[model samples]
Target: MTAAAVVLAALGAWTDYPELVTLGLAAAATLLLAAAWLVASPKLTVVREVRPRRVFEGGSAQGTLTVTNVGKRDSPPLLVTETVGGHRTTVTVPALTAGHSCTVSYPLPVARRGRYVIPPVELGHSDPLRLLHRDRAAGGELVVHVYPRVHILASITSGGPQDAEGQTTSSAPLGGVAFHSLREYEPGDDWRHIHWGATARTGTVMTRHVVVPDEPRQLVVLDTGSAPYPSPQFFEEAVRVAASFCVAAERSGLPLQLRTTGGAQRESSGAALEFLCTAESSGADRGLAALADLLRDVVSGTQGVALTVVTGRVDTEAAQLLMSLRPRLLSVSLAQLVSPDNTLPARPRGVLTVAARGSEQFASNWNRLVLR
Candidate 1:
């Protein structure tokens, strides 16, 4: 307002217009008064509430905001903003009454996964004359959790582990370790031996049905530590691999578990794969650090039905871990599965590794190794 007054006085002197000087003086006085009132206005307090703290990406969150003016007089209009997954938006609010409150509600759309911090809500109070606006900082923060992206895969095999579920198809008639059921013999059935007693009682032909043994339960250890050249595309590829494995395993009647060196373990029903999309992003580990940490964690836990460690590279520590587990478990290494020259160290018997160019090729790659 003072600056405005000075400008008006200078213009009045240059133009030598008495009417212009009077108008400028009146405008300056009004601006000065508004500034004084704005300064003397009471401070406002704001609160933000987000429903369902943990939400999946592509989900909607209904958020409510409450504003209360602690001052003795009515406050200016307010604007509330909400940020989600790095996206920002502003909302206009009605004038709040002194010592009274008003509520505003909006929807927050989550487009990506990961833990995100919702920045503080801002309160903007502009004077009636609209010369300037004052902003006040509000307290309180919100933490949102987003899960991983899920895709459909026809076959799910733990790339590194033995079959956890005992599953067999009708085509593979060879004897299996897991016993299913026995029935009267049928023509063309395995002639090893027939159930003579049951055949005699029924006076008809039947056959034996054996429950297929499921492949070993596979534990996919993801190396999420920082990479030399960080790329979200790499992370996306890793997620696709994990999703493909989970879907394939679930379809094959196998139980699967997920663990990460960069984050917590995610093990639940097949449906839990949805949350994996939001794994945390870490830029702390470099070179072989991620592989070392993954190996250490594996030694600490013996639950891996089959260990399939998914990483960007095959390091010495990882090779050693596989060597150590070779005698006890069927360990598979999935590193840059799509790249040429992708190879697994030759040491442990029954250990197979394959390069997976993409989701469509995972099954073919596994089929090549499985036949071995």
Candidate 2:
């Protein structure tokens, strides 16, 4: 357009046409005014609010942005762009008079599990010609946590050894303080252990039998090595399996320890879920060695600790390593994500292995296991 205006001005000078010169001058004045309009800064305030700061994977979250013109004079309509989870969406804000505000709402993407940061909204000011524009950031960044999907199972039985007295397993170990049952008093029974009420009712001396308490502890190891998984989906399934195990253990009142390539923790279910949300596959093969160290340390300190390992794929070397841990662990289980038609090699005698295509199948197979 600038080139055309210059040509018209030159033609008007050569042909001595007053109308052509006036038109060229008017075009130039219009361009100058548009540039000045775009160069001026916008006098507006922005505020953003995110609903349900935490959400599960594949869920939906919404954000509302309110833009207000603080200047006494009316402001031009502007464009507001927001970035969330690495994606950007833009909305048009209508012209606002002094002390007036316009609110716009947008849906945030939650297809994956992780902590996403929503940056400040960018306000774009431009002229009516749309030839020039300026963008200014407003407000502050907000963080939202996306947790993995947790499935509820009917029951999760401990695979550890049972008591010889045929006592039912409990979440905590039994002590003499916890009363179990009363039976006929034996000659060597302490007088304090005798139940006077039972003896009076049955016309025989009865002694209280206090069963020993047994607390189950489980260690969940998640392999995040990048070399094993054939696709990202498999790795994601592995994470979900680990998260499910954590949730199950927590609900069953069992002490659980979670180990991943990123790190390890023995906190509550919330902490474990947070870790899984941000866990990523690593190219290094250090997870196996880390698992071995963790198993050795845990076994040396605690006896009859149950262990479960989750991985995307299993090869001869990985299988052998898992098999070797069976001796030190009271019960060892392996969950591998693979194709439905894939056949795994024979597992070790004491090691329980379950192969499935996804998290749902894996949970079904795990729940059906009859661990001795």
Model 1's TM-score against the true structure: 0.57
Q: Could you report the Cα RMSD, in angstroms, for every candidate shown?
A: 12.8, 9.7
lDDT of every model, 2 decimals: 0.62, 0.76
Q: How much lDDT does candidate 2 score?
A: 0.76
- Candidate 2: clashing pairs of residues: 173-213, 173-214, 174-213
Candidate 2 RMSD to the real structure:
9.7
Give one digit per residue, the lDDT tens place, for model 2 in 98-132: 88999999888877899988888899878888766
TM-scores for every candidate against the unseen true structure: 0.57, 0.75
lDDT of 1 by residue, 1-372 (tens): 667677777788789977767777887888877778778867677778888776644576677888888888887777777777667778888887778988889887666666678877767777887887776667677887655444444343444434424445553334554455666666777765566666777887555665435455667766666462135665555665666666556666555677776655766534446556565436774433554465565456444466665555455655566666655554565534334344643333345555454434655566555654
**lDDT (C-alpha) at residue 118 in model 1:** 83
